[model samples]
Structure formats: C-alpha cells, structure tokens
Target: MSEAPFNLVYLGIGTVAWGVAGLKIRAWRRDPSPGLLVVALTIAAPATAFLVAAPVLYRLIDRVAHRGNLATLLVYLGITGFSAAAVVLARMWTPPKERGDAQVWDGATADTWHEVRRRLAVFAVLVPVMTVLFFTGGATAPETPLTFDTTFATVPQIALFLVLYQALFGFALVDISRVCFGHASRLPTGPLRSGIRLIVLGGLIACGYVLCKLIAIGAAFAEVTGTEWLSTALGPGFAALGAVLITAGFAGPAASAWARRRRDYQALRPLWDLVYRADRRLALEAPPSAWTERLAFRDLEWRTARRGLEIRDGQLTLRPWADPEVVTAAALVARRAGLDDEDRAALIVAAALRGAAAALNEGTAPRPREDQVPLPGLDAGPADERAHLVRVARYLYAPLTGEALTAAATTTG
Candidate 1:
C-alpha cells in the first residue's frame, strides 16, 4: 500500500482508540461535569486533528499542492484557536479547590490551567511563524530542490512547527493524566494510578517522537547527504510507537476501573493491600495522642509549681491536702472487704487500660497533663491525686467509656 493509504488507516485506528479511551475515562471517573468534559475533549482534539491531517498533508506536499495551503492554514488556525479557547473556558469554568477534600470537583484546575497556558503560549509563538512561512511559498519545492538554501529555508521550518505543536499537545495530555489519575480521590486505589503513570510515560514517548522529528527537520535543513532516510524512517516509526504507547496507557486504566466496578475486588486486591498497609502504618505509629505521651511531669513542673502534685519515681505524687473526692475514691476501693490491695490495684489497671483504649478508638482528645492543674481548691490529696492519675492514665492508654469511668469513686472502688 502507498504511504498515504497506510497513514490513513493508522489515523482511523488512532481516532477510534482515542474516542473509546475518552469514553472510558469519563465512565471511570463517574463525573459528568461540563468542565471536565471540555477538558477531555480539549486533550484529544489536537491528536485527532494531526491524525486526520497527516496523510492529506503528506499527499499535498508530494504533489506540490500549494492550492490547498489556504484550507490547511484555516484548519490549523481553527484547531489551534479552538484548543486555546477550550483551555481558557475550562479554566474559567473550573476553579481550584483544596487538596484531599473529596467533595471538591475542581481539585486539578490549577494544574490544568498551567498546562493549558504553556501549550497556548507555544502555539501562540509558532502559529504566526508558520503563517508567515506558508505565505512566503515555503510549502512548495521540487522533488529534488535546486539548492540546499531553497529547501532548507522552507520545508524544515514547517516540520519544526509541526514537531513543536505535537509536543506541546502531548504535554497537555500528560497534564490531564496527572489530574485525572494522580489525585482523583474517587478513583479506585489500584490500576488507576498505574494507568496515569503509564499515560505520563506515553506522553514522554510522544515528546521523544517530536524530538526525533525536530532532528529529522534539522538534518533536512542542513542538506546532510543520505539524511532523508533518517527523516522518513524516524517520523513514521516514532509516531507509530507513540500511538501504541498511548493506546496502552489509556486502555490500562479504563480496564482496571471496569474490573473494580464489576465487583472484581480480587483482581485489584494487591494494589488495595499496598494502600491499606501504608495507611495502617501511618495510623499506628503516629496516633494523634502520641503528642500527649511526650509531655513529661517535669514539663508540667516547669510550667507550674503546684505543691500538691509532683513526679517521683516516674509516678505522679499528691500531697496529703489533696481534695477528699480524690482520696475517698481510692480509699473506698481500698476498703472493699473481699478485695486485697493487689485486687484493687488490678481493677485500677483494668480501668485505666479500658479508658485509654476507648479514648484512642473514639478519637477523643488526649487527657490533659497535670500541668493544667485544675483551680487550686479543686486540688485533690495524695489518694485523690493517685485516683486522678489512674483516671488520666486510663484516658491515655485506652479510651474510657463514659459509663465505665462514672465518678472517680466507681473505678477506684
């Protein structure tokens, strides 16, 4: 088959693939926002334009079809202008939101705006240069040009512009992937992330293809002998490679999402396990109450010199004048006829453990350190202080149920 026909076939396949991928991305995200749809359309629009235009443009160049330049330029202007407009509209329609707030739909808007601005800026610079070059009769040349300068001044500039345009478009696609797959909290925690990474990789490969195109253009411009082979071979080869990578990148995430929706958890279990393990590690080691554990009795001493409570032998001590409420609770528990001091101590330990565990589980605030010494009159005696310490310790070690820790006397007794 001729290169034109072959390219046409490739273009058709690419368009179909991109369309399917866009639909899949939409379904996977479960987002029907108009702004998101516009962004998605914008991402695929450049690729679609290039794919459709490639074969026709190649044929026009081969046949020296300068008559088509007007139409071609118009198409380029339309695509580029629409792309810029889509970006601007998407930005205006979607504002940035705080990160990790799942309720926010426009979390990625800022990044999207940055990416769009960059791509528009590139096109803004290149389009005028291209228009000037096209109007100056650069698109038409003999099969073998009379001189290097004639071909060099014309063909390569056009090629360079296409190369830069494709690269900028690819970069924008990568930005879209970053937003949809990277930070999308609604996405299932599995292949979606991997798929986004693959998309980014594919975008990089597309960028590489454009780089190769630039190199080819430079070689053509320099009139390097036999370099035509490089230009011809690299251009189609890189484009094909980029297409394949992008297809895979787009397909992987979509398939993964579908699998998750089908309730095929086992298929995505490994990825979920990794996330679960990471979250578990973060929670266990840094349970917010860890801050309270760091506050020592000495820290309290430094803040206030309440003579009633002191740290001695790693235990909190209370003076004899501590409040009766505190002393009575411990004394009542101590007086239980059937219970020895050891049994009373055991109850205190269980109560403390239960209280701390409950607090941790319930997400309650850590017990305040003795440093915040309740108003002076509220100060309990040594026994009362011991009771209070037990209660506080319980609050810390295990969460206390309100019912279990009713009036300090209940636990002490």
Candidate 2:
C-alpha cells in the first residue's frame, strides 16, 4: 500500500474550487440574491464534494455497497449541481416573460417543478440500474478513479450507468449553454461580460469530456473496443482544464474592474504631478515618487479626487495673477492649431497655470492690476473639476503646449 504521491493536479483544482466557494459565500453576504445563492451552491457544493471524495473513489471497489457510488456522487451529482447553476444564471439575467414555454423556471430557478421531475426521473432510473449489478461480484478497477472500462466492461450495469451519467450531463449542459449564451449576448461591455465569456469558454472546454465519453461509449457499442483511453484519460483531463478556466472566468469581472481603476489612476499621474509642482501648498501631502506612484494601487479614486482638489486650489492661489491676456493668447494659438472647444479651454487653462507658476518662480511677476475685475476661480463639483483637470493635464506635457506656455510667460513678463 504505497502512498500515491500527493496529486498536485487535484491540489490545483481544489484551490480554485474552494476559492469559487468563497466568492459564492461573499455574493450571498452582500446581496442575498437566492438565484445567486443557488448558483453558488450548485457549483461549489459538488466540486468540493467531488474533491473530498476523490480518495475514496480512486481506490479499487471491493464492496457490495456503492458499487455505483462513483457514478452517483461524481457523475450524477456533478450534472445535478451544474445544471441547477445554469438554470439560476439563466433566470437571473433573462426576463421571466421572455422565458419560453419549452422550459418553466420558477422564481427560485433550479427548483422549478419541470426541472425537479426531470432530475427525479434520472434518479429513479439510476437507483434500479445501480442495484442490478450485484451478480457480477466485487471488481478491481485500474488506476484513475471513475469510468474504468475494465471494472465493468462485460456487465450491463456499467453501460446503464454511463448512459444515465451522459444523459444527465447532456441535460445539464443544455441549460448551462442557455445561461452562458444569454449572458454573453446581453451583458454590456464590463467585467461581468468578460467573466461570462470565460465561463462560456470553460464550459466549451469541459464539453470535450462528454465528447471523449461518447467516443468511448460508441466504441463499446460497436464492440471494436480499444478506445477506453478516450473516456478514462481524455475526458477527465478536459474536465479539469475546464474547471480551471471556469474559475478564472468567474473572477475575471472583478479583476478587470480593479485593473481598469488602477490604469485610470496611473493615467492621471502626469497632471497630478504638475499641480503638485506648481503649488505645493495646495497639496494636502507630499507627492509620492514615480516608482511609489506606480505601486500605489489602493484608494486610487480618492487619490485622484484629492489631486483634482489640489489642482483647483493651486488655480485659486494663482487667480490674482490670472491674466485674461494669457487665456486670450493661448486661445489664439489653440484655435490656429484647430483645437476643439474642450481642448481650447484646457490649453488656455494649462497656459495660465504654467505662466503663474513660472512668474512665481522668476520672482518678476508684475503687480496685480487693482482696477481689473478678477475672473472667477475654478468653481465646480469634484467630478466636473476632475474632468477639466485631467484635460489640462493632457496638454501639460505636450511639446506644443510647452512652447505655447513659454511664449505666454514672455508675454506676461
């Protein structure tokens, strides 16, 4: 009884399988959507159960009880749970009125009477079929748990078990296909959309298992019988690969959103830096270095909001020196360059900011004109302000804008 080296393959699968369970747990805690709950349970429960029971299923069967337990727990429960999850997803996204008469899904989704009865029929068939194999005596199946051709090759029981198992899988996958397609077709471009696509890809990959199984079943039926490897080897391999892909897909949306925000935060860096350099007093805290900025992934929206605030503050402090002439000159150059209205406004603001900063730096800024009425400072809500600041930032680093600012500084001087 040499201990089989720890199955690294199952170890990897177990990691994803448990992580998915955690997601389901979190979704339940957040919204308590029963449809989502059912989806979580159906996927997470069977996967966890299968992994836990693998050790028992992998060994040679020497008992009268559960001669078909592998078929029951692994094959049957796998179909049952996943099918229920598909139904749940379909109901969640698709409108009730749109769900046709072909399948009736109750508000609870997976528990619809139609689905229940159908699953019960399969269960009813399995109970008798599994019981009929006692006369064959105890069997020694080869390595790689479940679907061993040699274990019950000559027995009618194996054929019935395989048939029921495949039928159940086919039924479940049909609903799963509906959910995946519905999600892919309808969800707008976002993390959720991408996540659904990953699930769809994973489902397709997992379908390979069925294809391999069908090939093996066909070979058995034809009595040519040399392709057991298709079901025993290729089927589970595809299933494992699909599991990994599905897990990744489930996480895709959240991950994508996180990445998107991080990108937006990073994108605003150039402008944020300019505001800090122009008026250090406006900044609530010292700016982080470029390397630190790159690494700062958390609270990005808050940081960006603060950056906008400081940019507005910097403009306020520079207002007494706010030359309408700089705006006028900047506008002329921008218009000649064929800048759009938004770009025109942004470039004018950029030129004004650079001139003010340069004047304070040069220490030769002219005395404020007492008679000229001061233009209003940047007065807007944070969101609108942020948008304008981002625009200004865009032109801040441009060579053309730098030249314009230098020219504007000379004019002001």
Candidate 3:
C-alpha cells in the first residue's frame, strides 16, 4: 500500500483533533470541569500520536533528537496516554441527574481519582520500561516508520517492547468499548446515544488494529516472511479508519447541540425585540446589535439561555398590561379559522403579546388582576418553554396573527 494514503489519513485526523481540542479548551476555560479536561486530553493525545507518527514529522523528530526511531517511542507514549485518558473518562461518566446527587457524585469523584492514580502508577513503571527496552533492543533500522513494527519484531527486546505496549493499549480499548456499548444501549435515542455508539464501534475497530499488529509481529518473530504486509497495510488502515469514526463520534453531538442553540437564539430575536421595546429595563444587559448577534458563536448555550430569560422577564414586566379578553377572542377566531393546536396557541399568544406591548407603550391603565393574560408556558420546564416561545416568536409577525389581533380588537371594541 502507498504511504501517501496513510500520511493523508494521519494528517486529516490530526487536523480534526486540533480543531476539536480548541473547542474543548475554550469550553474548559468557561466551565473548568474535570470531565471536560479529560475529554480534551483524550483528543489531544491521539492527535499528537498520529502527527508524530506521520512520515514527515516522524523523520523530523528523529533527525532533531539525534536518535533513530525516537518517533516510535513518542508515538507509543501518546497512544498509551490516550488509552489512560479514555478509560478515566468512561469511569467518570454519569447521567446528568446522577451528577447532582451528592452521594453518587462523591463516589464517582473518589473512584475517578483512584483510577487516575492507578493509571499514573502503571505509566510510571511501564513507560520507562518500554523506553529502555526499545533503545537497548536495537540500533538503527533501514525500514520506514510505517514498517517499523514488522522490521523490528525479530529482535527480542523490541518484540517484548511491542508486546508490552500493545497489551496496555488493547486492554484499554476493550474496557472502553464495553462500557461505551452498555451506556449507549441504555441511553434514549438521541445525538448523545448515537455518538456513544460510534465511539464503541471505533474502539472495536481499533482493537482489530491492535490484534493485526500483534499477529504480524508474532509471525515475523517466528521467522515467517511476507507477513509485514499485515502490519504495514491492514493494521494501519484499521487505525486510520477507526480514528476517523472516533473523531466524528465526538464531534456529532457537540455540533448538533451548538447548531440547535444557534437556531434557538436566532428564533427568539423578534420576541426579544418586542419585549425590549416595551421595557428596556427588562433586559439584563444592553443587547447586541443584529449583525453582531448573528455572527456571535462563542458561548452560544449561555447566550441562548440568557436571551430566553430576558424575554421571560419582559413578559412578566408587561403582564399587568396584558388583556385576557384578547387571548380568548383570538383563540376563538383561530378555532373558527381551523388552525392546528400549535398554530392556534402561537397566534393567540402573539395577539396577546402585541396588545400588551401596545398598551405598555401607550401608558394605558393596568388591567384588573382577574383580566391579566397568563403566559402560555408559565408552568413548563425550560426546554418546553423555549420551544413554546420559539413558536410564538415565529408567528409574531405572521399575517394570520396580525389578522387575529385586528379581529380581536374589533370584537372587544
């Protein structure tokens, strides 16, 4: 197989790792959660491994260090670090609700710390042993970085080194695969569950990659010729494909979540404007301009949440001026017009809010407590409320809503 394809794969994986790592770093700066830090390491470690393993960087590192095959040591270290990080992440995993339970949280935290210590201890012992074994095993080999495993397998020291490294790597892959598969199976159908499933699948493929390398190494040590192709082509091929899937798996839920927040933030704009215009004091801070808001990408979840809160505050501030008669009238008009439940609710809320905004603007006397229009999602949870508010915002300028408002006014007149 051409080294070109493998080089491209390594490069692509490294690029994705850096991109995702940047996002993870930014998020950690904002939240600084332990899990987030581990997640970032999980990506950065493999990325560094692949980058150093790439033909160009492999040669550069070896040349710079004045040691042949030093890149191989670094690559193994990177892989081992990734395995440790992944296992730690799986051990620390907990549902959102369980994360809030003090007992469960404490237990998980303690267990995670213990696991971290255990893995660090293993690294301290195994890393130096692997390094000493690699250097003492052999001097310089003419084979390229891509074929180092097959070429060095005949040397007892190097073979032992490969065996030790693959043992830890394989065990971590199997452990994480099992945990991720179980968690994914129990998770409700969603982006998160799908992401976990992909990770599980990637881990299984990586296990295959490890198995292939070991098989080729054993064959080479047994004086078998031509098995180098397994290590050179088949093994690395599995690693490359597995890396792609794992990267995509991590990116999927995060990208989808960010997109959803962006959509919600944009969707709430008209409703935010309506409320802001009625009472600027309701805004927690000066609002961003339209273009700036549209272009803003960082902290989207926080921004969307804050924007929703501000809109709700504005609604509360204008509640005294809201007229229940308008909502009732609009609902009747919408029903007679045969709109669906969702559209009818949206149109009714839109008409009520419009009347409230106008009344607040005109300095009209506050309505009696009994006549005040209650918000549609007063009792809803945050997510349901946001969805309901987005619906109303969509219809805020709809022709049907405008017609309903006018008809309600005529009927109440």
Candidate 4:
C-alpha cells in the first residue's frame, strides 16, 4: 500500500478530531463543566496520535528528536491518553439509574468515578513503564517508523512492551464498546444513538488492530516468518479506519443539531418578517438588520427560539383580525387539491394568518369575532410548535392560500 493513502487518512481523521474538539471547547465555555472539558481532551488525544502517526510526520518527528523511533513512544502515549479519556467519557455519559434513593445515586456516581479514576491511574503508570520499555528494549535506534512493531517483535523487551501497550489499549476499546452499546440501545433512534453506534463499531475495529499486532508479535517470537504484513498493512489500516469512524462518531450528533437549527432559522424567516411588519414590537431584539440576521450564526439556538416566540406573539396579536371564514375556505380548497392532512391544515392556518396580517396593515378596524381562526400548534411544545410553524410558513404564499384569503376578503368586505 502506498503511504499516500495512509497519510491522507490520518490527516483527515486529525482534522475531524480537531473540529469536534473545537466544538466541545465552545460548549465548555458556555457550560464550563469538567465533563465537557474531558470530552474535548478525549477527542484531542486521538487527534494528536493520528497526526503523529502520519508517515511523513512520524519520520520528521523522530529525526527532529534525534531518536530513531521517538515518534513511536509519542504515538503510544497519545493512544494511552485517548484510552483513559474514552473510559472517562463512557462513565460520564451513562445516565444514573432512576433509583429514588438520593444517597444511593450519589454513592453509585461516586463509585463509578472512583473506578474511572483508578483505571486512569493505571494507564498513567503504564505510560512511563511503556516509555522505559521502549528505550530499554533497544527498538528506538532503527528508525522503522512504519514497521517498528513487526521489525522488533522478536526482541524480548520490545515484544513485552508491545504486549503491555496493546493489552491496555485493547481493554479500553472493548470496555467502551460494551458500555456505549448498552447506553445506545436504550436511546431513541436519532443522531445521538447513531453516533454511539458508530463509536462502538470504531472501537471494535480498533480492537482488531490491537489483536493483529499482538498476533504478529507472537508469531515473530516463535521464529515465524511472513507475518510482517499483518502489522504493517492490516493493523495500520484498521487503526486508520477506526480513527476516522470514531472522529465522525463524535461529530455526527453535533453536526446534525447545528444543521437543524440553521434550517429552522432560515425557514421561519418569511413568517417572521410578515408578523414583524404588522407589529414591529413583536421583535424583542432589534436584530442588526434582515441581511445580517440571516447571516448571523452566533447564539443561533437562542435566536431561533426568540424568533419562534416572536412569531407566536404576532399570531396572538393578529388573531382578532383573523377571518375564521378564511380557514374554512382554505380547508375546502386544500381538500379539493388533494393535499395531505398536514399540508391541508398548514395551508388553512397560513391563509388565516396572511389575511389577518393584511387586515392589520390595511387599517381595517379590528372587530371582535365570536370565532377566531385557531393557530396551529397552540398547545404543542416548542419543538413541535416550531416545526408546524415552519410548515405553515411554507404554504403562506401558496396559490391556494392566496385564493382562499381573496375569497374571504371579498365576502367580508
């Protein structure tokens, strides 16, 4: 295999890891919690590992250190740190059992953290031990960046070092996969569940990398030949692919949430603008401008939520002007057009709101009606309400909606 692909894969994984880590850092700044910081560091650890493992950088690093394989020790340390961080993340992510006993819950949480700390302490001890073994094993002088494991597998010290490192790394991979699978099974289907599944899969593949290296080392110790390919090709390949999957796993849920927020923010614009024109006071914050508001991504969740509330406020304000007959007319038109129940309802609401806004703008005296056009999602939660509003906005300017509003206005006028 060409080193180009390996280098590219490693660099790509590193880039993704840093991106995820940056997001976590941003979140940590908002919440400033320890667990959030740990999550960021957890991702950064493997990111550093892969960057160091890139063939060109690997050789460059070792050469710079004036040690033949110093990059190997650095890479191992990064992986060990990642292993410990993964364990921490797994513990932190698992929800506390729903026991009513507060003390029991506290004790359980404490015990879990204690176990996590104990395991991490063990990894800490192993890091220095592995470094000692690497130097003492006489495996550091040959500059075998890509083939270090297989090349020195026959050396007793090097073999022992490899075994101990792989043991710790493999244990972490298996433990995390098991825990994540259990937690993921209980989660409803969504980006979070999907992300956890990807992590589990990545951990399993990383386990393969550890297993392959250990087997190759064992084969070499037994004076077996022709197994170098396992450590050099298959093992590294598994490690690279696993790293990519794990990075994606961390990024998937975050990216999904960001996309949803952006979509909702953009989708609600037309309805927001219409209501804002009717009553400028509907907007609590003087958004810099319409163009800047569209371009703004900072505090997006807050802005989207504020926009939703403003829309709801506008709907309530304009309800007195709404012609209930518009709702009836639009419903009939939508039914005749064979629109689905959801779209039909949305079109009806859109027509009512549009006519109401027009009435308010036209200086038509607001008259109290016994029956008002009911707004969609009045009793729904914020998310469901926003979703329905987005649908209503989509049909706000539709021909059927316009026709219904015209028919109602003509009759009412």
Candidate 5:
C-alpha cells in the first residue's frame, strides 16, 4: 500500500488497541500494581506516538525539518517507552520484596540506579543534538516534487550517531524481551502468559529494525550507496509488526478476564437458578430468565460481583432451613470417607441443602438455630466469592454429592 493507506491502517488499528490497553491499565491503577503501571506507561508511549503524534502532529514539525521529523518523534517516544519497559521488566524479574515502585528508572536498578540517571542526564543533552542532526542529514527526494530543499544525506558522523542510538535501543528492547519471555515460558496458557509472549515477539521484531538501521549506518561510513531500502522499507515493516504485537499484548489481560467472567457466569447458571427461585428477592435486577439477560457478556466485573452478592443473599435466606445436625452429621461421614477440606465444604452444604429442600417441600419453614454449622455465607468476602460459589455449584451439579447426602441421611436415621 501507499504511505497514506499504510499510515491510516496502522494508525487506526494502533489507536484502538492502545486505547483498550489504556483502559485496562486504568482499572489496574485503582489498586496500583507498580509493575503493571510501568508496563501500561510503556504501552501508552507508543499508543500516543502512533495515534496522536505520528498520524498527523508530526506534520507540524515537518514544516520546518521536512522529512525526518516523524522519525525524531518516534525516537523520543521509543526512548521514553523503552526506558519504562526496561524498568518494568527488571522489576518483574526480581522477587516481590525487591520491587519498590518499578515506575521509575531509579526503582529498577535501585543501588545502581544513579548510573542510569547519569546516563539519562547525558541523554537529555544529546537528544536535541540528535534531533537536529537527524533533520539536517536530509531525506530521499519526494517521489512527486519539491516540498523542501533536497540535501545529500550521506553525512558519515550523522549516520554513525543514528546507528549508535538505534543499536542501544535495540539492545534495550531485546533485553527486556528476554526476561519477559523467560517468565512467560513458565506460565500456563492464559492471557498474562500470552501477553508477555506477544510483547516479547514485538520487541524482537523491533530489534530487527534497529539492527537493519545499524547495518545501514555501517554502509554509510563505508561511503557505499543503494541500501536506503533497508532503512525505509524493511526497518519500518518490522517496526509496524512489533507495534501491533505489543499493543495486543497489553490488551491480553483485560480480554482474558472478560472471557473468564463470561464462562463463570454461565457455569454458575444452574445453581443460580435454583437458589434465586427459592428466594426471588435475592436477585439484583429482574429474574435472569430472559435470553438477553442470561447471555449479555458485558459489564463482567459487576456481573461477577453481583453473582457473589446474590449467591450470599440466597445462602442467608436459606439460613432458617439449614439443618445444623445434618452439617455435623455429614462431617463425620466425610471424615470416614477421607474427603479433603474442599470436598468437606461441598458435602456439608450438600447435606444441609438436601434436608432443607425436604422440609421446605413438606410446607414447613425450619426454625433457625444459633449453631447453624456455617452453611456458606459466613466467609463471603469479595476476593474469594466466585471460588466459593463455584464450589457450591460443583456440588449441586454432581450426583456424587446427592449420594453423599443420602448416605448421611441414612446414617442419621
């Protein structure tokens, strides 16, 4: 594709991906994981450049500097984002107690961080010089006609300067990627695992661009001609590939979370149906009977929260029907069967609910007792609510729990 079409596609896709990653980062910031925040900022830099700066704003600089102005913006953005990525990678590579903030360069290298600062101080001075040299080194003649004066861009020192900058940048990109991929390899097939891998892949591709530029720099110093295509086409193609992958990587966690919520919401449906019907007032909205209501997958976090909320509410309403003796009686049967703690919880709930269902069917509202064997709602904290409910659902669905309840009932009789 031509420059206009290519830029538009890249800008369009990059803007949307970066925007999604930004929202995910913002949500994470509510609790503020320092490592995640650093990674978010790292993602934000490129998103800002591709969406905000490169697509159009670079034109303002091009008015004076002409051709290489957009590249200058890229270099600055790479510097900022890469530096943050380095910090995040370093923080993640270390143990938990070691990571203080990971948002700053100082946090990454801590005892040796002043060296990073000293280099940054020097970099602050060199950036302006490099930007000036890049623009002055000149551009390929516009395929159509003259917008600015076409100066020969084979300046030896300038080529070497650009090459050195790019080489160091490639080194950073690849370094962080190594650490990220190292950790990602150990993770299971999940969003976080996949995200890290994608980011690493992007970094590796980006390193190809930097390496190509470095090679072009060598040719420039050798006074050779006819390799501009390496810098122009190959380098940027790799760069585009890298940007797309990294953006997707940043978006992985949120997408994964949403998928999990959708799955869990559906998985709990059977139990939800039973308990909600037993106490219709427990539901937040109207009955989740409508097709749209049951299948709507948006607002997952809130839905997940409400699931736990209504579940606990239902469990509380079942309190009066909960048979303490059944829970106590089931514990003995569970012990004799060598059930673990989790299985014990499941069977206890199963046995009590069985007895409760029997009494309720006979048109008897069983009286509540103070010692109710802690049926399900006592430990209904937000963090583990989903897990708690899933256990209940598992027991409710399995015929084994019903059998366990029958055995307990027979033993009690």
Candidate 6:
C-alpha cells in the first residue's frame, strides 16, 4: 500500500480502538443503564462506521480531486455535515435513563457534557470564521490543487475532535483509576494496585500528548507560512503517541480483573495474616476498665462504617455488608492493638451491668427513649465525631489501657 493508504490504516485503527473502548466501557459497567447504553452505541456505532468508510473516502478524494476540486469540497462538506448531525442526534436521542437521573450533575458524565458544550461553542464560532477565510483568502483558489491546503483546512476540525475525544477518554480513565485506588487500601498487594498505577502513568503520558498538540497548534498560528513541517510532524506524532498510551492504559484494569478472578482463594492470605497479628497485639494490651467506656470501640466502629460496615439488630454482624474479610482483619487489628482477654470479658460484663442499671433507673425515674430526647438540644452540625471516637477508642484499647480504663470507669460511674 502507498503511504496514503498506510496512514489511512493507522487512522482506521485508531478510530476502531476508540470505538472498542466505548463498547468495553459500556459492557464493563456494573449496571449499563439504558440511557448509558444508548449513548455508548450512538457514539461508538457512528465512529466505527466512520473508520470503516474513511479509507474509501480518502481514495475517492484522491480521484475526485483530479476531476474537479468542487467535487472534493462537496464531499468534505457532506462528511462534516453528516458528522455534526450524528453528534447532535446522539445527544438529543439519548434515552432518559442514559441522560442520567441525577438531580445534580456531579460525576464523569457531567464532566463529559461540560467539555462537549465548551468544544461545541468553540467549533460553532471557529468553523464559520474558517469557512469565510477559505472563501475569501484568495491566497489559494478553491480550484487550487488539493495539496496540504485541503489537509490544512481539515486540521482545526480534526484537532477539535481529538481534543474532545481525549478529554472524555481521559476523564473515564481517571475515574476508573480513582475507584481502583480507593479499593487498593482494602485489597492485598496485587494487580489491582498495579493497574491503578499504570492508569495514572498512562493519563500523564496522554496529558503530555495533549500539551504537545496544543503547542503545535499555537506554532501553526504564529508562523508566517500558516504551516510548519515541525509543527505538523509534532501534532500527528503526539496524537499517535496518545493513541498508543490510551491502549496501554486499559492493560492494567484488564489484567487486574483477570488476576483477581484467578486467585480468589489465596489472594488475600497476606492481608489476613497482618490482620491476625494486629488482633493478637490489641487483645493482649487492652484493659478491662477501658472496655467499660462507651467510646472505647468507637474508632473501630467508625473505621468499619467507612469501609461500608453497619451495626444491625444489635449484633456485631460483619457479613454481606462490606467485604467481611476486611472487617474481620480490622477487628483483629483492634484486638492486637492492646485489647486483652480481660477487656473482652469486661465488655460482656459491662453490657449486663449497664442493662441492669438502666432497668433499675427506668423503674425509679421516667426515662425517655433515645428518640424522644429533644433533637433541638443536641449539636447536630457536621463534626469530626468519627475522629473523636477513634481517639477515645485507641486510648481505651492501646498500651495506656490501665490509665484509660480507670478514667473511663470513673466518668461512666
């Protein structure tokens, strides 16, 4: 194949890669809501079709230029019109479900729309200006042989599209990375962490490409000739590099998913061991008196809550809420931190004692239910209650258990 055809192939491949990414994203979504699915299909289907047709269009351009430049212009205009319509229609026809039920715009979709709006405004203004310039410049006749000028006219359009495409894809990658990294804290050392790191690196590399492209565009505008070989070379090189980087970006997540499935049985062994050690230490150090304080285990509960655990039916139910293993591991850490056998025994005994005292007090006095207590009297504004709980819990369960327990007992009494 000629260089033209070879370049077309690269373009085709790049387009297909983007299409595949869209489909993959939709497929991988835990819940591919109908609206999102429509959005994905609308974007990806047209993009894929464009790629498949691009080579034929390129060949037609070459042939039609020999016959007449107007034919080439018509073709270009038609493609542009069709592409614009496709984009607008996709946005309009998106299902209500995919349109997002969010009362407030907040996540990845919101960011994508904001970018889309910005890019649309830019194109709306610039395309008209460019069209006028193309007709009036007299610098190059419409009839002038299609050389780099034809390519040049399309440059801004291509650059704009590339910018929007990168922004959307980059945002998706970042969101995914954030999720993966957030899970990393709970996960054992594994491919999940590696995947998140790869995505971060890939995003940085992609950003560099975007920066290079912007610099090239600025150079093109500043140069007297309106085009520089260096600028042109740099722009395409950055775009191609960005394409490769995006492809590499998927590697981490894909690998992580595969690894997690394959090693489910033994993957968390190290994490469990660490938990076990921490639990042992805490159990040995915590004193009986410390366990009497209501806040003694508050920190642990707070941490558990952050990790998606909950107290249900007044039982320490640890399963089906968050990752049970993670909660178990945390419990072990609390035990090893200094909570001792005496502390555990005291917790049981204190619960009974408190219940008895509460019963006797209720018989003697008109005790109000917790809910019946006036909410107006309580400071309900946002505060770091969890932090306070954690501090108290740590003090009650740590090496200073003896002192903490005595203070806690006195305060409670």
> For every model in order, what is the number of clashing pairs?
19, 0, 0, 0, 0, 18
Reference-based TM-score of each model: 0.45, 0.63, 0.89, 0.85, 0.73, 0.35
Ranking by TM-score: 3, 4, 5, 2, 1, 6
Model 1: per-residue Cα lDDT over 1-413, one tens digit each? 24665466557755766676477455437756545555455446545545544555444544565453343454445446534644453343332244443222343466766865775686788778767765564554333211222244336566555544555444454454454444445444566446545555655565555565556556666655554543455555655565565556556765654433333222222222222232343222322133442332222322222211222211211221123343334335445534465444433433333333334455555444542222221244543553434333332223222323454635446
TM-score of 4: 0.85
lDDT of each: 0.45, 0.62, 0.82, 0.81, 0.63, 0.38
* RMSD to truth, every model: 18.5, 7.4, 3.2, 4.1, 5.2, 15.9
Off by over 4 Å in 1: 21-35, 54-66, 69-105, 108-122, 140-189, 259-413
State the TM-score for model 5.
0.73
lDDT of 2: 0.62
Q: Which segments of candidate 6 are over 4 A away from where they belong?
A: 1-12, 15-19, 22-30, 34-57, 60-200, 206-227, 258-413
Q: Please write out the lDDT profile of model 3 over residues 249-332, one tens digit for every residue.
A: 877788888988899899999999999998898777777888998898887888888888888888787788877777877788
**Candidate 4, 389-410: lDDT as tens digits:** 8888898898888888877767
What are the per-residue Cα lDDT tens digits for candidate 2 across 98-156?
55421112254454545656655665676456445432423333333545543454456
Which one wins on TM-score? 3
* Per-residue lDDT over 128-227 for candidate 5, one digit per residue giving the tens place of the 0 to 100 score: 6666665565543442111111112356535645655665577668777887776676665767778878888988888887777666556656667676
Colliding pairs, model 5: none
Q: Which ten residues in a row are the worst by lDDT in model 3?
A: 99-108
Which wins on TM-score, candidate 1 or candidate 3? 3
Clashing pairs in 4: none
Better of 5 and 6 by lDDT: 5
The residue-by-residue lDDT of candidate 6 on 57-84, one tens digit each, is 5455546555323333333343333234
Model 3 TM-score? 0.89
